[model samples]
Target: MPSKKDKGKAKATDAPPKEITQKDLEKLAKDVDKIASKVQHRQEKALAKGEPIKEKKIDPAKEAEMRKKIEAMVQALSNMEQTGAIKASGRKDMGDHKFWNTQPVLQHGEDVTEEGPIDPAVPRDQVQQEPYPLPKEFEWCEVDIQDDKQIIELYQLLTMNYVEDDDAQFRFDYSAPFLKWALQPPGWRKSWHVGVRVSSNKKLVAFISGIPAAVRSHKTLHHLTEINYLCVHKKLRSKRLAPVLIKEITRRSHLEGVFQAAYTGGIVLPTPIATCRYYHRSLNPKKLVECNFSRVPRNSTISAMVKKFKVAEQPSTPGLREMKPEDATQVRELLNKYLSKFDVAPVFETDDDVRHWLAPTPEVVWSYVVEDTKTHKITDFFSFYTLPSSVIGNDKHKSLNAAYMFYYAIDIPEKEAADSYDTARYTKQRLTELMRDALVLAKQADFDVFNALNLMDNSMFIDDLKFGPGDGYLNYYLYNWKCRDIKPHKVGLVML
Candidate 1:
């Protein structure tokens, strides 16, 4: 009763499903069995090799129940994947990532304890006591740097022992000009300078120095004393005398009504919170190549690019000059702009931070600025300040000669948006040029060495200058601190 087309359709429908022979089913089963056997063998070998088995030590009934539960989960996942209801991989949520990364897994029967929140304001218990007893022969005497002879001896000792190690940019040579500037009278406090001496011999052996922190926007209500230039003579390093010097300095700080102290050093020595991150930039392509500072390139493009860039000098179009009071507003803008690119930068709120950092005691702080004279706009700036050494003994008046570099910036023109990388390259190039200028200034000023930290991206810039990696690194430890909503700039000093 059907038409010809209907009969054809029915014939197509009548075709039986293609038959899978028993041999095919058997082959599939064998393949699966082989795979399962291989997995079991691997697991067994691992166990024999002392790898812990995943099996939990539970009652037999409980073990069986757990296996069933796991099997159920596996089956549910398989079904969901097969039905295209869920992804087979890359299904991680934020919570899953956090849990995987941060959450600790507890072992069975392990005790669970919670750590109370940390209080930064409360100082932790001292771990190690002062290594050596205070020398009875040495009288705890503070030296009046006002005395020209004492000041000259102090400078001589610092220049001899604490002089710039090979990697310093600005050399701290103990010059007569510097002593005169440092010891210039009335307001300079003797309490800031302390020394230890053997009552028998009037040799100045150990020394410490502190300076008031007065940078605006970065100022602390409590006077902060920076402890720096701590060195024991090479022969005396083993005497465990560094701690005594540190304790003595602490006593002085407390006497001065100072509760907090900060210093940067190479070793993660005294305090853990003081450990700072180091950033480096490469200046000399040949040096970078020799030192293995350059990263291995994934391809030739990067390698060729670096080689080409290295051969060329960064363009220096802007003129540089000493920073003036009028340049504060522009300096602040530039600082804020450059610093915002980083996670941490010096906190500068008011113009005072700029003044203090740039002009701190005209004799101690030196600042330089690069400008577009035609436009009367400042384009870049950098500053450095002197940090004195800690006091040890009166006879061994050893001063640690050092200077800190701070607040550098560069601005790229709007027209050069496409060539900003070139602008940055030029900016870095300018640092080298300016450093040479700083060196000349430092030599005249009689500093042993100009010390600056390679924080964040500045590390990259520092390497370009051929500066030796300093043993000293600055660190940050926060106290009674709440996380501020604002993110800091990446390039400048992070600590206030």
Candidate 2:
């Protein structure tokens, strides 16, 4: 019998497993049926679209024997995975990853000494010609976010079925504007916004999206895709639709000549090129405590805890102000120069890209810049974006407003000299000063908390500024590419 767990094929649960029951077997049967329907649908879609469908001869006796063997193996594997003996990333062995092992990604426990694509790029003509087939009752649709109805459908689907915590006490609430900003960045392709919908009712049940990115790994630029927003309705997760969604998106990226990709997840998968810890600074401790998102320390009073985390009333930087459209060019230069120091970072090409990313959007993103009062040069800049988590089952609050630290840069003049130690100490002090003001700004905006990853120069201030380490760990993975592992300190790219 398979062990019962609530994790998706591509997701993991931090909770203890529940005992398997008859209901679990029935659900498993439906999942198997869904997959079978998709296999049948592939042939039909191939004939309809005039694409080749590689067929294998059916042998009834052999098929039945094979099916029994496969079922036994799957059941055993499921039990192992549910027990944490195996992992979503196939930690036990390469063979555990029936799907990932065949893909061009780094294998678990494989040491990476080189940095480059695992496979060379192929011509567009050799890429997949049609979307991956879905179950007969389901069809593929490419979302056009400009359409309000379509946006609303996506919003509704994710609002109900997206990322959730182990306790089911919180869910990510990505606003329509945030989705628009996240999905519709410069050079975004409509084709990459893949959706799986019920053919009978045209209701969306699954979705995965990819956006173009020129990510640099080990200072070598790779034109790749940043894959995100993978979701399947809770009712259909057992259908194993996530693998199909991933394959479809990868195929779509292939058609665009992008052979490499990047993604982040809470679950530990086949391999992580880099792992980062989540750190949080609570602004509204009372709200966090009320929502069970935080607990009062062993020997601290609520009033004392609140006072301990109090931020300054105003920003202390000399010329820090809201970033403007005109400052985009200067900020881009500063970012590019600063990010080059990292092993992995995004290359901000133009002022437009800077404006799109770093410019402030009311309630969506807050950006600030400090000017050199004498030179009028943009000396430093920092930004954070808003993402509110729904406080599930909380009687007092509906949402927990969070501000996530985004890209930032500090001016450490190379010519105006100091030793490495002194430079590092100075940089830390400058960033701490800047981050303190950022805390004040975020608090003023009524954010319940501010969160950041242990990446870039963030480590320099997290301790001095009193940010607490969070239990959540995020693993960063690169798809179809091989690269030496990046330490959290060298990760300069911030994915939304």
Best by lDDT: 2
lDDT string for model 1 (414-475, tens) is 65445854455455555566665655555456554455544534533444444443222333
The C-alpha local distance difference test score for the whole of candidate 1 amounts to 0.46
Candidate 2 lDDT score at position 209: 98
Alpha carbon lDDT of each predicted model = 0.46, 0.79
Q: How does each model score on TM-score? A: 0.47, 0.82
Task: Give the 10-residue window scoring lowest on summed lDDT in candidate 1.
Answer: 1-10
Pairs that collide in candidate 2 are 89-270
**Angstrom error at residue 334, model 1:** 4.9
How well is each residue in 59-97 modelled by candidate 2, as lDDT tens digits? 323543443344334434443454466554444444576
